[model samples]
Target chain A: MVKKEKDASTEQRILDAAKQVFVSKGMAGARMQDIADGAGINKAMLHYYFRSKEQLFEIIFRDSIGRFVPKVKALITSELSLYEKIEQFCDGYISMALENPYIPMFVLNELHKQPDAFVRKMFNNELPDLSKLVQQIDEEIKKGNIKPISPVQLIMNMMSLCVFPFLAKPIFSILMGLDELQFRNSIEQRKKAVPQFIMDSIKR
Target chain B: MVKKEKDASTEQRILDAAKQVFVSKGMAGARMQDIADGAGINKAMLHYYFRSKEQLFEIIFRDSIGRFVPKVKALITSELSLYEKIEQFCDGYISMALENPYIPMFVLNELHKQPDAFVRKMFNNELPDLSKLVQQIDEEIKKGNIKPISPVQLIMNMMSLCVFPFLAKPIFSILMGLDELQFRNSIEQRKKAVPQFIMDSIKR
Candidate 1:
């Protein structure tokens, strides 16, 4: 392989490894040596690639926000009606979360630890533009398509329904005596249940 | 004050300080010195009281579980009707969480870090007795009093709706440009909105 190709492969490996360590151990507990080991590279390569854990975490955090927010923006702003959007979001998000269970907690924990970086990445240019979704909800209310509820409250409900299960899975697993498959099965149940639940509450 | 009273005061102060530090900084980032400083006692007194950070954290963690689980147990297992239980849970849990914003994340994060401990404290007696509540939902469904739904799914929905906002508050605050009072007003909205949402979803 060419030297440039090898360099790209190594960089990708380092990022994947760093993301795993950061997600599992969190920002405070994760160590550079751990990331280097996970990546199958020496300390020198890890340092040469990212310089500091903060810099590497910034990359991962930025990438997570990039992957999550824009899709949400697109879905809400798309031509689909609000009910269709809710159904699609519930189905798609649960499936996505089942595959990438770490993202919800990792992003929230890191954001809790450091909000400034996330705000900078997500706040400007209406990149996320939640106001737009709020506006959409308002328009729906105007048409008497849904109950007269606060848009922000509706947004909060949609988010909580979709996101909370992923973070709370382990706790409930222990509480409910659920094995891994059982928990995932319950999550699968939400694919239909959540959308139905939301539509039931909001439909006029 | 007597020596016993004085010692008790210092211990209480230490516990309060440690709880705050653990909640804000998490298990990995919190320091003994910070707890000591916050408690207004030197490291020596702190050591005399708790011996080690692990011991101190264990006390605080167990205290938290003791305070939280028993109340929920009583509320759910009480003679209240299924619908009343949901309404009470939404109303009471939100109000409690609003007052003690730190506990949910702190218990969750610490539980994430060390499940063995939380499990040991909370696992038996069905001390929290979630199955009883699940059974209550099952009976309601059987009697055709409420729409058919999996008890587990319903529980997950209620938990998500009530808990996610506290963890996500800062991120949303920045996103929505909501100051503390406004954010609080939105939470107040949930006191009614969440109960209404949950009831609407489940009522036949």
Candidate 2:
């Protein structure tokens, strides 16, 4: 039992270190040696654990996507009003993103680099069904709780508001002349404020 | 005059090709040879026109940022009603982004790669001021024209909704199972619907 726990801990350490390197350097630029260095292991240990760079990246990427997609799916299916869902989504996504700001950019950059491979992999993975959320939006519109609008638009809007800040962090920080702490504080402020702003704009 | 016109045309061609390559491949992955190939020019001619890859990239990046900032500034300072301004901003931003689906991602990726350099260039270029927009939002709130909210939050939300789709095209396409046409149509729909959505949520 102890040995199993130790192996699990070491594997997690490699994953964490690999994620950091991959996020910063991207696939082409990241090196196994660097990941090994970051994980405080030798290259042989890295190979012993993950076998190859591609395998390691796939594991990290899938792990990152898994973390993000399930929460979004849960938001879609939750027993909340549309207004409440928007609020939940904004707060939840921003908070989650704050903890993993690099994930969106990392996923996006790789997707741009290898669209076919990334898309196929993502699709093969179980993703959230947005159709249910769409139906909910339609019902809300039909019931006169909100104005008529496509759920896709709402989803896009909600997601954009939630994710763009992290994706554009460097430019946003530069444009706003914010340091790391200041940038983080701004995002924290947006956590509550963005949802309120969205609700204010959309509620009947 | 003829020579000047020809030079202008060549420069425009180079810019267009550069935009396509840079947007698709990103800065690190993009090469001058590929850009020249895309433009149907020889490598020496490409260099003669733009001096270096960095110089060529700067032209496109600056031009893109210039196109984006002014329209947003107009949203803030225009004589339209608060609701009208919001609609106009959403419509304009979505339209522009959809047309150049790769611009946001390209700019964002480069910004991440070289934050300080990009930010300094943008700052030195005199980005649009949001002070007037802030004041306008304050006035709107005082008169109860819209829900009371921070202008910064409002602006960020507006931008986030408009920009995130293009930024996350790969993931969104996979998650939603949208082909290029469906994705394009969805954006077109957003152009018309986003303003109303925003108005519905915010207007008392």
Candidate maximizing lDDT: 1
What's the number of clashes in each of the models?
A: 0, 6
Q: List chain B TM-scores, each candidate.
A: 0.83, 0.81
| lDDT per residue as tens, model 2, A1-204 | 245664457788889889888777677657889898988888998988887898999888777676656676677788887777887787877777788777877877888988878766765655667777788889988888776666766677777877888887776666555689988988899877777766665556
RMSD of each: 3.4, 4.4
* TM-score of each candidate structure, all chains considered together: 0.86, 0.79
* Candidate 2, pairs of clashing residues: A200-B201, A200-B202, A201-B201, A201-B202, A202-B201, A203-B201
- lDDT tens digits by residue: candidate 1, B1-204: 245764559889999899888877778878899999999989898889888888998788777656666677789879889878888888888888787777778767866766756666664435367767888888999998889888888888888999999999877787778899999999988988888898887787
Candidate 1 Cα errors over 4 Å, as ranges: A1-17, A33-45, A48-50, A122-127, B1-16, B36-45, B123-127
Residue-level lDDT of model 1, residues A117-187, one tens digit each, is 75565644454566667788899999988889988888789889999998887788887888999998888
- Model 2 earns a TM-score of 0.79
Question: For model 2 chain A, where is the 10-residue window of minimal lDDT?
Answer: A1-10
Stretches of model 2 off by over 4 angstroms after superposition? A1-18, A29-52, A74-88, A177-182, A189-195, B1-15, B40-50, B67-85
| CA-lDDT, candidates in order | 0.81, 0.76
